[model samples]
Target chain A: MHELSIAKNIIEIVKESVEEKDLSEVDKVVLKIGDLSGVVPASLLFSLEAITNNTELENAGYEVINVPFIVKCNTCGKESNNEAGIVRCTLCGSNDTGIISGNELLVSEIILKN
Target chain B: MSVITVERKILAKNDEIAEQNRELLKQNDVFTINLVSSPGSGKTSLLEKTISLIGSKVNISVIEGDVQTSLDAERVANYNVPVVSIVTNGACHLEAKLVQDAINNLDLAKTELLFIENVGNLVCPAGFDLGEEMKIVVVSTTEGDDKPLKYPKMFRNSDVMIINKIDLIPYVNCDISKLKDNALLINPGLKIFEVSCTSGEGIKEWCNWLIENVKGKYIHQTQLVY
Candidate 1:
C-alpha cells in the first residue's frame, strides 16, 4: 500500500534528525498516528522493516501511539471521541462540528541506545 | 539512553512542497482542484463530461495520475486541453512532489483552472495534499451508499462529493439520499452533486459551479492586484 511511501518518508525524517550520527545508534522511532490518518500501523512497520534491512537502521524498532478521532461540537462545544468516525456532535446532535484531532501523522520522538 | 523530541509531521517534506505549489499556483492565479475517487468510480468520465461542458469557457489543464498507463491522459488530451500524465509505476497515491514536477511541463500562464486527477484510490490520497484549492471525491451508485462510512477520511477531506453514474440507480442498490446522509455525517460542509456523466444529467450545474469558483477566485485576486 501507500505505507511504503510513508515508511520512506519516516526514514527520511529519521535520517535528517540523526544528521551526522550513526544510524545504528538509534534504538526506536516513536510515531503518533491518528485513526483517520489513512495509515495502517502494522503495514507501516512491516514496510519500515522490509526497507531498512541490511541498513544501519535495521535493528531499530517502531513504537506507534494511536490517536483517537476527536471532534468538537461547534454548537454546544462538546468534545467527544468518535470511535465510529462520524463527524457529528455527541451531545447536541449538530452537524456543525469540527475535527479537533485524530488526523496526526507525526514522528514525535527518537530514542538512542546508551 | 537519550530521547530526542522530534515533534515533526511525517509528511512535512511533502507538505512543504505542497505549500510551495499552493503559493506558485496562487501567484499564477490558477484555480486548481484535486479530484479523487475509488477505482472505476467514473473519475475520467466525469472529467470528460466536465471538460466538454466548460472547456471553451475556461482554459483547462489536467494532470492524470495512474499506476501504469497514460490512458486517462490520452482521453483528456482529446479535448485539446493541456494534459500531462504521471505514471507512478506501482505507487498507490500521488504526492505533492510528483505534482510539482508535472506542473513544470505545463503552460501555467495560459491555464485558468487545473485538475489533478489523483490515482484511483480512496485511502492514500486522503493524507496527501496536492496543493489544490478543493478536493472533489467521486462515488458511483454501483459502489453503494456506505462508501462514505467505509472511506470516511476521503469523504471528510473532500470539499465536494460527486455521485456519478446516477443512470444506473434503478439497477443498483445505492440509495442516493443515504449516500448523501452518510457523507454528510463525516463532513458537514461538503457540497454534493448527483450526476450521470453518461446521460448528461447535472453536468451543467457542476460546470457552472466550477466556472463560478474560477471566476470568484480570479476576481478576488485581480482586485487585490489592481
Candidate 2:
C-alpha cells in the first residue's frame, strides 16, 4: 500500500529533524491529514509502527487530526465543509467553486524530549 | 527533561527533494511526463503506441517505475530507446528521489522527452510529483466510467486524461459522456483524448496533439532565447 511508502517518508523526516535539532528521543508525532488527501490514517499508523520498530522512533506514538474538505463557492462567495464527492456550493447550489482547504497532508507538530 | 515542540510538515522533506529534482530536469531541457493509472489500464500499451508513433521524431527516454519486475522496461527497450527500470520493491508510488537517481543514470544529453510510468495505482500516485512537466492519467473503459468521480484528485492533478481501450467500450458498459463530464467537473481545462492502443484507433490524433504540444514548447523556448 502507499501508506507504507508515506510512512517511510515520515520516518525519514523525523530522523532528520531529530538529528538536526539534537533531540534525545521522540515522544509523539502530530499529523494533520485532509479528507481529500487520499491517505488513510489507520493504514498509515499501522505502517508507521512497523517501519519505526527498530529505528529511533521505536517507542514514538502518533496523533492524527482529520481535516474536513472545504470549498469556496464562486457564486455565493461562501466557504463551507463539503462532503466527499460533492463539490457544489451549499448556499447557492452552484457547481462553480474552488477548493479552499482539506487537501493538506502535513506533520503539524512533533514532541521530543531533550 | 525539556520538551521541544517541533511544528513541521511531514512531507516537507520529500517536497524539498522533489524541488531539487525539478530544477535538475529544467536545467537539462528535458520535458518529463508522469503516466499514472490503475492496474491493467493499458499504461504500457499506450507507451508502446506512443513510442511507435513518435520515436523517430524526438529523443525519448523512459523511466519505468513498478513495484517489481522489469517487464515494462524491456518492452520500451525494444523500441531502441534508452530505458531505466526502477523497482519500488512493493511501494505503490514513485517518489521524487527515485526519479532523481534515475535521471542521474540516464543520458540526458540526447534526451528531449522523458516519460516516467508510475506504478499502477490511481490514488497513491497523485500525492507525489516526480519532477514532471505534465501528468497523464489513463483510464480504461473496462475500469468503469465513474473512476473520475471516485478518484477526483488523480483526475484533477492530471494535465491530460487519456481514455484507453475504447475498442472495449462496445463490449462493456461505459458512458463516454459521463466519464468526460466527471473529469471535466474536477478539472475543467483538462485535455482529453480517446484511443484504443490495440486497434490503433484514434491514436493518430493523440500523437499529433502530443507532438504539437512538445514542439510548441520547444519553439517557445527558442523564441525566448533570441
Candidate 3:
C-alpha cells in the first residue's frame, strides 16, 4: 500500500522531533487522520508497524484520531456530513458545498522518555 | 516522560518540496500539469495525442512515474520530447522529491509546458503534490461512472477532469453525463473535458484549453520579464 510512504513520512517527522529533544527513546505518537483523507487507518497502522522495525519508532506505540468530514453549503451556509462520498448539503439540497475538515493527516503528539 | 503535541502534518516535507518545484517552474515560465488516473485510464494515450497534435507548436517535456516500468517513458520518448521516467519501485504516487529529481534532468529553460504523469493511482496520488499548476484526473468510459464516488479524494483535489475513451461509450454500460454529474457532486467547480484519443473526437477542444491556459498567462509574464 502507499501507506508505507506515509508511514515513512511519519517516521521521519518523529525522528526529527526525537533528535531535536536528544532522546533515544520515544514512547508514543498520536496522529490525527481525517475520514476523507483517503488513507485507510488500518493500512497505515500496518505499514507504520512494518517500517518502524528496529528504528526509533519500533518500540513506540501509535494512535490515530479519526476526524469527521464536515462541509459547509455555499448557498445556504449549512454544514453537513460529507462521509457518504456525495457532498450535497443536507439542509439545502445544494451541491455547492466546501469541505472544511476531514482531509487532515498530521502527527499531533509524540511522547518521549525523560 | 512527557508528551509533546507537535500537530505537524506528516506530508509537510512533501508540500515544502512541491512549493519549491512550483516556484522553480514559475521562474522558468513553464506551466506544469500533474496528470493522475487509475491503471488503464488512458493517461499515456492522452499525452501522446496531445503531443502529436501540438508537439511542433509547444516545447513540452514529460516526467513519467510508474511503479516498475519505463515502458511508458519509452512510449512518450517516441514523440521526440524530453521525457524522464521515475520508477518508484512499489510506491503508489509521485512525491515532490521525485519530481524535483526528475526536473533536474529536464531542460526547463526551453520547455514551456510540463506534464508529470503520476503513477496510475487515483487514491494515493491525490494526497501528494508535485508542484503542478493543475491536477487533472483522467477516467475512461470503461471504468464506470461512479468512479468519482469511489475515489473522491482524487476528484476533489483535481482542478480538471478528463473523461477519456468516449469512443467506447456506445459499447459500454456507462453514461457520460453520470460521470460528469458524479464529479460535479464532489467538486462543483471542476472543469470537465470529454475526449477519445483513438477517434480524435474532442481532442482539439481539450488541447486548445491546455494551450490557452499555458500560453495566455505565459505571454503576459514573459513580456513583463522582457
Relative to the true structure, candidate 3 reaches a TM of: 0.94
Model 1 ranges off by over 4 Å: B218-226
Q: Answer with 1 or 2, whichever has the higher DockQ.
A: 1
Model 2 ranges with Cα > 4 A deviation: A18-25, A54-56, A85-96, A112-114, B1-5, B220-226
Measured over all alpha carbons after superposition, the RMSD of each candidate to the real structure, in angstroms, is 3.4, 3.8, 3.5
lDDT of 3 by residue, A13-75 (tens): 887777744445788889999878888989999998898787546778888898998998899
Tell me how far the alpha carbon of residue A21 in candidate 3 is from the true structure, in angstroms, after superposition.
7.9
Clashing pairs in 2: A107-B10
After superposition, which runs of candidate 3 have C-alpha atoms over 4 Å from their true positions? A19-25, B218-226
For all predictions in the order shown, the interface RMSD in Å is 1.0, 2.9, 1.5
The number of clashing residue pairs in model 3 is 0
For residues B25-46, could you state the per-residue lDDT of candidate 2 as single tens digits?
Answer: 7788888899999999998999
Q: Write the per-residue lDDT of candidate 2 for residues A1-114, one digit (tens) a residue.
A: 788877887777677666644433778888888888889999999999997777657788899988888888888899878665457776787888898777878776777765
Instruction: Report the CAPRI category for model 3.
Output: medium
Model 1, C-alpha of A44: deviation from truth (Å): 0.3
Best by lDDT: 1
Question: Of the pair 2 and 3, which is ahead by TM-score?
Answer: 3
Please state the Cα-based DockQ of model 3 relative to the true two-chain complex. 0.73
Clashing pairs in 3: none
Q: What TM-score is obtained for chain B in each of the predicted models? A: 0.96, 0.93, 0.95
lDDT of 1 by residue, B62-139 (tens): 999999999999999999999989999999999999999999989999999999999999999989999999899999
